[model samples]
Target: MNKLAWVLVSISFVVGSSAHAQKEIPKAEGYDQCPLGYINTLGTKCVSPIYYEVEPTYGEACESGWMNIGAGYCKKKTILGIF
Candidate 1:
């Protein structure tokens, strides 16, 4: 009886956890499903490649170790240091 109860409890726990797992996201209206890390807002639009703000240089030259990206902005230059 003890073994049977434990088995049933374990089964219920597994099923319950699975049931609470995230469901498939529906496709955006008139578009395919959104890529990972992207989300569909308002059920009618899928925003991808989200936008971000970049700090402006305000007419100053790019700081050392940074490269000028034009338009008064600078972007950090990556150094691979690979031989």
Candidate 2:
């Protein structure tokens, strides 16, 4: 009987401690504890992207690429294959 009661209590506590149960307590007035650490660029709270390096060769320009056909990317006319 005691073992069953203890098991039930533990299960309830585990379920109640889920992420959904987390409520951000406002620190000042219009802000909370930042959810975890920082606010994302999209104004959401959680893990965000970490910049490691730049793009690969035939890199970023303004628009064009092998995929986009023509705009401003690689900037090479032969590479553009428009001739």
Candidate 3:
């Protein structure tokens, strides 16, 4: 039926768009070089693209345990466990 075909098309479109939204960036051995759309943290871990927003800091400082990711946005740092 036409309705069934439309439903299949819709589902395929959604799946395809979701898959294309985010491409996995390879992890680096160090904290300096992160692929596009990822932020390099102090622990050498790359955060998500959602946290890579740039805002105005206006001379304010980031909170404790959070790193100032340029502009005014502060991203939480990854804490390694001693265990």
Candidate 4:
């Protein structure tokens, strides 16, 4: 009987803890709102935008030995030779 009661208590505690953890906290005022493709810095809490090189347009001429992969970018082709 005591073991059954303990099991019930343990299950309830696990469920309650999980529910509490899933709750979202409201953002406080004066907090920086990070833009798209940006992330908040850990220490300073500043917004750091991520940047990437501009990809070439599709159907455009690619450099020699490179082929367009249809994702606005070109990739170098690999040639396999017998060892």
Candidate 5:
């Protein structure tokens, strides 16, 4: 056994080049028109927009009762405010 036939041809060429480098991301064409909070999950790649707080505008300045909640941070809008 010549080193088990070169280790079975190097383990089938490393499992056929890792199954052809696992590639399967081709289906774009308005990928479900990703927008609000974006998310396409590989239909062509769009997942990237999950803000949770901080989105106020016009001279932003949240504090007394907190507001802005888009992606910067400012929650407490109502909860018997205290902290």
Candidate 6:
């Protein structure tokens, strides 16, 4: 019957759309990278001469790690989705 066909069509539409619905990757809930030479610390950016000091602040989700942006500092939340 037309009613059955309509129900089937609706179900198919829902299932088809679900397949295309991509899930977003998880992201760190904190600041990434640093303010150039400055390193992120205690949820704040700071200046550091050594590279190691800045790596941890970016978290491990980054593709490689936070890079020295420009001016103050910045970090991309979803770099490459390694996780």
Which portions of model 2 miss their true places by more than 4 Å? 19-44, 48-83
> Local error of candidate 6 at 8, Å?
0.3
Tens digit per residue, CA lDDT, model 1, 1-83: 99999999988965764553232333433444443434556564434352312234656676776665343434444334111
Among all windows of ten consecutive residues in candidate 4, which has the lowest summed lDDT? Answer: 20-29
Alpha carbon lDDT at 69, candidate 3: 50
User: Which residue pairs in model 4 clash with each other?
Assistant: none
Candidate 4 error regions (>4 Å): 23-83
Compared with the true structure, what per-residue lDDT tens digits does model 3 show for residues 2-74? 9999999988965654553333333443325544446656454455544322222345786665566542344
RMSD of each: 16.3, 20.0, 11.6, 19.5, 18.7, 14.3
- Distance (Å) between predicted and true CA of 52, model 3? 14
Off by over 4 Å in 6: 28-83
Q: Which TM-score value belongs to model 4?
A: 0.27
TM-score of each: 0.31, 0.25, 0.30, 0.27, 0.23, 0.30
lDDT of each: 0.46, 0.33, 0.47, 0.40, 0.42, 0.41
Q: Candidate 4: what lDDT? A: 0.40
Which digits, one per residue and each the tens of the lDDT, describe model 2 over residues 1-79?
9999999998886565343322222222233323222233434332213211111123344344322212111212222
lDDT of 4 by residue, 1-83 (tens): 99999999988965654442211122223434422223445433322232222224445776776555333344344333110
Error of 6 at 76 (Å): 23
Ranking 4 against 6 by lDDT, winner: 6
User: TM-score winner among the candidates?
Assistant: 1
What candidate 5 gets wrong by more than 4 Å, as runs, is 23-26, 30-83
